[model samples]
Target: MAAPTKTLSVADQLDQLQAARKLALTTPVYYEKIVKGVLPIIGPTAPIELRRWGAEFLAESLATPVLAKNEKESLTIAVLDTIKALLESGDDDPIVLKASIGAAASAYPIVVRWIIFNSYHPDPWEQMSAIKSRVFRIWDTAPPPVKLACIKFAQRIVLAQTVSNGQEARLYPGLDVSLGMITGSHPILDPRRMEAEATGLLDRMLGVLQDNSSDALLVDGTLNCLSILIRTRPSTSNRIINCILNFNPLKLANSPMTPKTKVLVKSMEKTTRMLLIHIIKRDPNFQPGAPGSQQLGRIQQYIQRLERSKTEIFDEAGRKRALADQSSAQYGDTKRQRTETPAAVAVTIPPLGPGPHRYSALYTITNNAGLQSFDATQVPHQLATRIVVKTLSSISQGVLDFAIAGIRDRLKTFQPAPTPSFAGAPPPGAINPATAPLGVEEGDDDYEPNFNAAEDTEQILNKLDNAPPEVPLDHTEALDLGPFTLPSPPLLDPDTAIRLAQAAASRLFGPLSSLKEEGSRKPRAGINRLAASSYDRESWLTVVTRLATRSTAGLESNFKKEETGRLALNDTLREMLFVYILEDWRRRIEVAVAWLCEEWYNDQLIKLSGSGAPLNYEKYALRLIDGFLNYITPQDKVLTRFLAEIPELSRELLGKCKTLCGDPTTVNLTLTSMLYLVMMRPPVRAIALDTVAEIWQEYVDARPLAAKYLTKWRPGFIESQTIGQSSAAASA
Candidate 1:
């Protein structure tokens, strides 16, 4: 071989020259030669082919893995130097600028890492800014993944500056732009992105600390991000605090420190101390004698210890000097030797008297006609019991009695008409009053004895005599006369009442059973009949429909029919009706109670005597004293209403409740229904605590049957207690 025969084409010669020129631009050791040779090639007529070949060679060099690490670093610095020269050259060639940017991107990671690690270099901050600006410009037009990487690099630069004592702060001039890249255009930054990128960055920094154990740089960077996060997004601060708190601070304490790490630790300690102080100050439950006082005391003690520790960390010489100063200060402290006086004795008031149930009387009377007419015909016994209970529970005894009296009085007004008078013959040409007179004649002398006047006089005499009055002979004869006596109105019969009761029970319970037996052998026809018949009467059908229409769809089909029947009686129909009635009653009661409270609060008795001015002080004092009284009085009124209506409705409905299955054991069922209704009403449910306590005391004192029902449902009482305890714990 004649050593490749030296047969070079013009293109081959030009390529060799371009490769040498590119190598000179990348190597810092060849800076003088490149500046001399490449600086003069920038004129308009400069060889286009040679310049293009040089730029291509430079771009290719970035991908070479065989380059030594030191050589690669040298190449990065040289490329940056050339970029600065090109930018200052005032060359506005789009192609050249684009080529330079592409080349710089290929070597960006290597350049950034080198510059960051060697941040102590004199012009490192300036170099970082230059690099960052270049990266951002390229990133604006780059693919998403590349843009994301650029953001990551910017974060690294911020971290690097934070570690270097704020030396590179100016490097992150477009921080908001960088954040936009990471979070995209989402209104609320996606937590998933935050977790992946931001969280991972912190974890990586933490990993660096873990691996190196003495990497103050990494620790400082992590703390900077944490501090920024705490300031900008306070809700996320708790999460970061939890993360740090879970870590053993003692491990970090044992690690070697640069002065920077020690400063960071001090800053964190101060932040924690301030946070704890604020938590303690704002919490009213932290005070003594308050509900959770003991837990508050423990937390206070822990915070005090932490505060003391922080003082010790900052006050090395002051801690020792403070004890000596305290001893000297106490030497002449005569005021400290004086004993404190005890507080004046408090006047004790006697407890209040028993509530209104003691003074009130409760009774029930059956509407015999209503009972007989509807007992077994139209009403099912179970359903009738429900309706009776619902109606009775909803109204007060006073209201019920008033309603009954009104209805009876109205009935009496519809009495039979008096018999026609044909006893005397009319005078010739004298028209009969009933036949001829369309209107009553004024001043008529032939006036007959008024039968209504005689009847009123007879009733008055009968009332005064207090004896059974004799029936008149003509009245007895009129009773036998056709068309004189009216026919008896239809009374509520037992069978009809029973049918109504059963119908109600089926309507309430049947749907629940059908839902449970959807795909089973039992036909859903009976349930459908029950639902259809009682749909108008039961309110829970609406609730059931709403609940069934939720995303979870329908109720389970595996429920036992008997169980569902019982539940319908106890939970759905009775409960819903009770809640409805109670709510209506509660609203009315609250209005009355609030008015009474306002009146009592503003009463003359509550004001100071003989003062023209309003006695605001005395008025407030009386409110405190009479507040319980005001609450209880209206409460009693409401209870009285409830007791009157509930029991009567229950008794009436129960009497009517004889089902096809025969009279179901209904006393317990009725009681359960009453309890369900009372408990389900929001107002009643809200006051469950006060109500239970009041009722329990009454039960002890009066031993009423209603009290016995409350005792049977004691689990509800315990649940309220548990809730109170949990609330107390949380406040503590």
Candidate 2:
């Protein structure tokens, strides 16, 4: 025996111990042996071997399964008893505590199950609750990893019990004691556990309130926890707000404790104010009229009390800090207060562009229900015209009401009747019934008189003597408004005015070639007539002058040149002038036509310009001519081209006129006028056809009640062209 110990070196002894521990971990009997053997050795200053052995034994005990229900129960009790003893052992050693935490984590499920089964057993939850406080105490002194393990254990136990049974069943009667342990532990403050712990605590706290139906408990618990969390971590503020918003409102409303309800409400208000102030101070473009304004308002009201309670919350210093923080985050650097002062607020209203004005008007009309009831008649003529012109010029709401009013007025004034002058007369210098072709047989001479000339004359005289005196024919003629008078002469020469007018007119009325061949066969007589009336070079010049004057006045001060220059050479300035002139003329003409149609014409044109059936072509023609003369300016080349071509077409169709004047109501004529005017401008000419096509497509897509009208109008226009062309060819 003397040399037996010498046979094993220190390394060999350690190897033997390692082998035994592995065997204990793998085999049930060996595992129990290790637990019983190592428990007594787990104390302060224990040999390093004994410490290792104790840790290994605890790990094995947790993994080992006890047979039979009774044995499992006994094993769970033993594990809890062991944890309790270790907690009371007064060991502050980190390694020992870490080992204990790991062991306790592993045994949590078994302990929870046992406690649930023995809930009626004397102090079943109480015993575990006592251990819970110890867990927190150990966590406070332990390393971060060990602390994390403790939180993990708590989460697992809660999750396991909750999955098997609802929250009420899982949270034991003494659950508050364990919650206190968690609260004091401040697990939610741990960076690694913050999100999960916060979420769990929120759920638990809310569940407890719901089950107990006690607002006081819930409000107090939640507020206290939130206050602590907010102080430590402010980033979770948004997430908490979302949770509160999602909770059952009815439950909160029905809370038994009014005081508690008030407190909760106050807390919510405080949180809301904090969020809003942060957002407003940080966001430069934040406005009360933005999309989320309503939601933001509700939040603001919620926090109004808090704002009053803590007036300093929004003080200059706080605002400065918040701004500094925001800037720091944005630029990822420390920010300093700027030495320069902020710029002063601008007071003057800036001039608007056609695009912006039109867009603004459209947005207002489409999105704002309030504008629908505005009375067009109430608006001033100049303002209304400007609005309409600006809106039509681009697509903004800058002058929405004005534009709408202008359009309404124009629509009202549209006339359905043709001018008597155009309807009563043939083309200038054309043959009249009063001056029929010479040498034409006047009487029915081919049919022989019943008797010789003298006898026939005597018989005719006898018959005339016997016949009663002839009655005079009563004829009524429609009144004609005189040719449109231009307010002023245009700045441009007659030739230039004609060219510009033609260009403008073509933009409004597209080319005949673009129409279908069948449709092209008949040109609406009214359109031709209107074209002829508008073709008066002098009248068109007057229109151009009026338009140019209005446009020059309406332009934004910033863009206008201080000094005058040649209008033709300055392309940019010329383009601006051209746009302004067109816009001005269009608006004025629309207004004038609306007055004429609504007041003078008795709204007849609007009714006549239908989609189905033929329109009163002559009437539309007269309206167009009148509208152009009233609105067009002399410098407008586009309008001139459009008007110039109309007379030729009108002349060709006049030969086929069965009556002195053709019918004014015809879809063909209306479309022809619209198309011709659209094609007058080069830019408009390029897109006009496509625009009309798209409009038709959209009309069909919308399934509007007026779809039939559109369809019928398009075909009728074709018929008018066909009829016109046939008659023209025949006359030629």
Candidate 3:
């Protein structure tokens, strides 16, 4: 055998590593050669360039196709050990840290396999924790690239640990399994170890997202990681959701921060929208919060029940004390103190229980009740598409409106593109014209205005070079809202003509529809399915009916029973409702009319079917109409004025009534409900009563109820006799 070559210098090793990048992509290098030669160059004493290139070589070497798992095992360990040395050493060289992270990521498959074999090791998390801890410790000081690599590695591991029994995850080609795969049929190790470490890793990613200094790359990686984490371990889903909500970009504006570049802003919005889509699509129950793990869910419920029980007891005690005689009040106070002392102390005393129970996300979609701040500049068309498509399905009806607003705001980014002037057309310079859009004066038609192109160009150049014009100094410029000040949105870049054109096309082309998925508890990627403007009112109506009805159809028995859950938009979609209905108001009105009619028909059919399924059609129909009214009518105000503005809505209600009142017995029931509404909504009392009087004539059975209001117009009371009797009594 030939004598082994002399050990390569660090510089030589780096040179080879750099050259090998291209080779590694096409053909894997020998793992032993990479470990012994390239890896040594990454030692602390080596130059940053040498170390970075060296670490990168180790990352590529792990994929040596000629080497099977057994052959690669020793190399994998060697590579991971080097990376651990680099990372754990707290070497702050960003290039080195970043490269080592990439190196570690490349070895993720091996790491997972090793963990699989040692699933029952006394310290299963020991290795994972060490790796994760080192990453976290260095993250703040590391560059964006390093943070991004760390995030990707965490996601890979999380996806691997995703407790799949074949159905949950698809196997890769050739190989049957990865991500905790083990021998034969039982490849997966204990999932709890992976899960715990993954959660910690997720937490680390979230920290990067929360940091103000984080760049778009870091944000993008964090979001992608979160998407996988939610899929794999849904226990902390609510916490993840809250983090997204609180990571508000709008709020980031008007604060002292490194101003974001346009690309970065767009990227952040895009990433956030993508993240939202992942979340809303997973919780198939189409509700705001995911359920905690069973044990945690039960624990939360138990605690809530106890708190409610305590409140009730205190309420009862207070009521009794108020009604009690002096003697009894004193005795009751003593008894209350004796009982309540331990209750208050119990809250202070930590419970001797196992680790905290798991629950789904805590964030809720409160329909339009909670207003979310949306910056006019940040969430342009790309972002709006996500908000509209995902949030509108079931989480929030308001998403339709919110999306419209976001889109409109984004559309403002584009100014209509100017038509390119043909050559030799007087350079398309200013011409005196009667039709100048800005109202410039017209000159004589024959007047050929002399132009100094160079002077004009100089003037234009001067304007460009000039500092921005100053504005007059103004007052305090802030509105105090107790703890906060009213904010002004950040200045936006001038609209790009191209984006406007694209948005216009997207809006006109993309009429949305929901597509159900197989076996998924949540809605599928029912993203923008744009349509032509020719999609008439009826077609749009069908879309709304299908989406809305499906949301209700998928509800759980308990969700249907909960009053607050009814027709309420999910919190994520809080700002969208008003904008949605008003967009194509005529078409939307048509759809709403058709939808209500359909609901009425369904209610009648369900009742007639007598299936005894206890369909909550009554509540549904009432809330369907109520939901529409809630959007149109301002809160803490009567529905009268707003109801009048929506004449078609009233017409639809009356038309539906006319159709239903065709049944004689139903006329009285319908009129009575109408009367009840009139009484409750004082603002709309006249419209309600007037409607009842006008429609009651169709059915004589409704005449008795009409008597209550006849004196004004329906003549239920003898007006002339009543007037004369009142006059006679006054005269006497």
Candidate 4:
């Protein structure tokens, strides 16, 4: 007789239900089962696991695009009662609430469309309305995931109820159930009421953004909703943007930041930035003072404020920059060491020599255990074939002995007993254990050894260890067939590799490099190398210059005589500095001025230390100044500002400035340089006045240009110069 059927336990039933759910969701033909079979299994009376699974299944089935609109509509009608029961059941299970609310979100619009079309079946609409009401009642008190799901659900309601234009209707069909979609509203279905409900829900979502103490999940959820609504609904864009404008993403706490608050701040700022970027990109044709220009401007300004707040909240201690400074200091020290001893640490490109004429090993066999455990299939096909061929080639008599011994041991350990030679028994050729030979077993008999089995296995292992090495396959040599020879593999050693890379780079960058040089011959590299004018390079130069100039005053005081003369801007670096400035002096003039000022200041510091000779500071300073005078044109006004900003105006530098007197432009340039020193640079004012007085007495070309600004700037100097001229005339 057939065995009686066994009943499944609760867990077994849940497992079967899960299996069915997966099959239904994965298979397109079984998708209808989610609404029909799956919907009946989830009720108030069902198990929680079954209900959770059913809720999640309905959620996926409804949200998925695989199901057609009519299929989804029917599914929505079938699952509305279950969704309402799941939401109102007050299970407090996050999975149930999240899945049920998510399902409701996907089903909400379909049910609204159904009610709009039929106007007779109001049951689904009422069920969905009840589900939404239950969700709202628990939204504030629910867990974060459930609350987030409800926020999305509310967004769907707003999108479905809000009236879409004709263009939007064609884009996303059947989503809108507005009065605009149909003529004459029925008593049961009021698009106006539905729209008002959506409006209230939108206000509620915005309220989360407005609250200073809202949860992080809620705030992010609300911003996400705003992003969707603003993109999908054009009518709500302005109000949403305005709401985002006033929302402070970092207003979570007024106290010092903890780890939790830090996470919240980061999440909120990231979401806010993404949303602002999205909104700005939608209408990026921004013209200042235009009709919609103010809105985008406000958004940009808000993003700036958000960034500043992030910096303040997260990096207020400057830890990131400090780490960068430490790293740069370490790298700078290493670079300095290398540059100091260039000959000792040479990097000569090694010559290309013929490599060993043998194929490379596919994998190194570290030990016998690793070799035994290694899987050849895991390797690539080409390598696996090479390994198999190599292994077969290396097989020897000792290896054959080891393989035979291994097979004998495995057979003896698992050998079955011999049965009598009958119809369904062992065959006539099967050995009887009593008459079997050594190391073989039969008929429940133990293995018989002619000698010690342990000693024999050890001898076989030793033989395996001493097996002959495989013959090497040399790919470098040509393979000769009966009438043909195959070519050798290509050589890719270090020297050839370097040469290949260099050739490729030269081909790609040859024209660009030439263009860089040609452009460098002029004032700038233009597009050839715009990095010369980049702000990062400018900031780097400024920072290092200030660090050396402002921070080295005390270092010179306690230094040994030899170390006291060590300037941050050494000879080679100074040469590079001069070239950098002369290449693009107009744009990088401030960098040059800062370096010169630092040099001048450090020169004073070294002088106070009573060094053997004047430091090279004056040498480098004069070189930079002369270089500028030589390279800068007569009408270039940038050099005037550069010279004025120099802290110390030495006599040698002033003498160079007094000699430019060939034309009106040259005279004006010289006079402007001297005038800026007298007016803007306070510390150099006296020396500049002295140079101006000397220029006024000595050079007639610069006198006319100097008199205009000097009269207003240094009236006393001009008068005293006139008196000195009179006294000199009287004495002469």
lDDT (tens digit, per residue) of candidate 1 on 330-394: 57555546777989554322222334322111122233556534435478889989989999999
Q: Estimate each model's TM-score.
A: 0.18, 0.23, 0.33, 0.42
Residue 148 alpha-carbon offset, candidate 1, angstroms: 12
Q: What is the C-alpha lDDT of each candidate?
A: 0.44, 0.45, 0.53, 0.70
Runs with alpha carbons beyond 4 Å of true place in candidate 2: 1-17, 43-45, 64-72, 88-91, 118-127, 160-732
Best by TM-score: 4
**For model 1, what is the error of residue 589's alpha carbon versus the real structure, in angstroms, after optimal superposition?**
99
Better of 2 and 4 by TM-score: 4
Flag the better candidate by TM-score, 1 or 4: 4
Top lDDT prediction, candidate number: 4
- Cα lDDT, model 4, residue 373: 65
State the lDDT of candidate 3 residue by residue for 101-197, as single tens digits: 7767656656666656665542323554576678767667666787677777776665565444343445344222244454434434555665676
**Regions of candidate 3 where Cα sits further than 4 Å from its true position:** 1-13, 19-23, 29-37, 63-74, 89-91, 118-130, 160-168, 173-194, 208-217, 236-238, 255-264, 278-732
Who is ahead in lDDT, 2 or 4? 4
Give the CA lDDT, 0 to 100, for residue 682 in model 4: 80
